[model samples]
Target: MPVLEVRRHTMRSKPGQHLSQQGVTLASLIGNSTGPFDLVWTSEKPRAIETAIAMGYTLTRQSAALGNLPKSILDAVAWPNDLESISKIVRRNNACERFARAQAEEWRSIAGELKDNQSALIVTHGAIIELGAIGFMPNATYSTWGDAIGYCEGFRFSQVEGLETCELLRVPSHLQLIHN
Candidate 1:
């Protein structure tokens, strides 16, 4: 099976467009332990691109779809929602479902293109990751997923027999601590 690991960009100051110095360090640490991915993708946002580079991966692609959700969608769903809430919204909202489906298709297409034993990495934003995961695995138990993803947190998705599976990916607790 081919795997796709999708993560939000590393830390950035609120209202800032670029990665913070600590974000660079955190991404470097993450790179050391994870992936020699076959392909890497990012959002068009500088923070996303910088996270991939800091993780030492060559950029394979960038898409704005991974960066920003539409204003209408943003207005419809509250920010920082857990998977369960997002799932409910997806089921009830046509626009949300459409966006989620598109995200899932992009992930599937990327994963499908890879050979067996190969994997891809996508560094994107929070809501995009959550919606894509829910869209890809609608039957998954969302209540177990806890809160929404934070910086550098996301999911690992893989396909088997035309069905998709998702696993939450979290940065190590040690790496999450702020240094004085």
Candidate 2:
């Protein structure tokens, strides 16, 4: 099966648009164990692009659709909510739902382009990752998914019988740094 590993950008100092030095270190560590990915993608945001570079991958493409969401959609859902809360907003709010569907479709489109046994990596933001996962796997057990994804945390998606299945990806506890 083709695989897509989508992860949030690593840590950035507050009020900065780029990754911190420590973020580079963390991403490098994570990259060490990760892949020889067939393709790599990122949001156009500097932080997302930097994360992929730090993780030792070159950009295959960057998309505004992956990073930019309208202010209306941003206003409709609270930032930093848990998966279940975001999933609820996705169901009731038209803007959120539309954005979520777009995210899901983007993931599918990327995965569809991969050849058998190939894998891809996408580096994006927190809410985009969460919404995409929920959009792609609506019936998943959200409550067990805990809080919003942290830096370098996201999901791995694989298609089985034409349906997508997702699993959470997390920075190992030993590698997690305390953010001030």
Candidate 3:
């Protein structure tokens, strides 16, 4: 089944933010869903929670398994070159690596709980989404600390034995739009 990894829509609080468009798009997508959703999940943050509510899903328990991220240990994250550095960093921190490992394990367990073809929506922070997805992929490995994460970007994967490596399905819909 396809997981609609929606980046939560805009917050009225942050007037004129890029995320507003993402929020609008998410609203459009959810409004268009004709089938029943098995579950809806969201981050503790108000923006994410409000987006989930607007999308019309009743709340499931919030997940620390999907919470705001701790920064990675690697130096400045630049990708390509930084990817190797990040992987090296993950190889260094026993605790951070452990967290990543645990997260993947939990997602595997969570996938089993869902009914076959059951549609579930998880409204969460971008870091958690990246940690849950890229941190769990195959052929790719990383340091437990210092993973470069961007906002509102995430992935989708089919559950086989465990949560498979995911493709980045969405990104923060707006950032430049956010103003103090």
TM-score of each: 0.92, 0.93, 0.59
Candidate 2 or 1, higher lDDT: 2
User: What TM-score number comes out for model 1?
Assistant: 0.92
Best TM-score goes to which candidate? 2
- Runs off by more than 4 Å, candidate 1: 160-163
The lDDT for every candidate, in the order shown, is: 0.85, 0.87, 0.50
Clashing pairs in 2: none
Of candidate 2, the 10-residue stretch with the lowest lDDT total is 171-180
lDDT by residue for model 2 (89-154), tens: 999998898888899899889888899999999998878888888888889989999898888888
User: For all candidates, what are the clash counts?
Assistant: 0, 0, 14
TM-score head-to-head 1 vs 2, winner = 2
* Ranking of models by lDDT: 2, 1, 3
lDDT score for candidate 1 against the true structure: 0.85
**Regions of model 2 farther than 4 Å from truth:** 160-163, 178-180
Candidate 1 lDDT over residue span 41-62, tens digit each: 8989999999999989999999
Better of 1 and 3 by lDDT: 1
Clashes of 1: 0
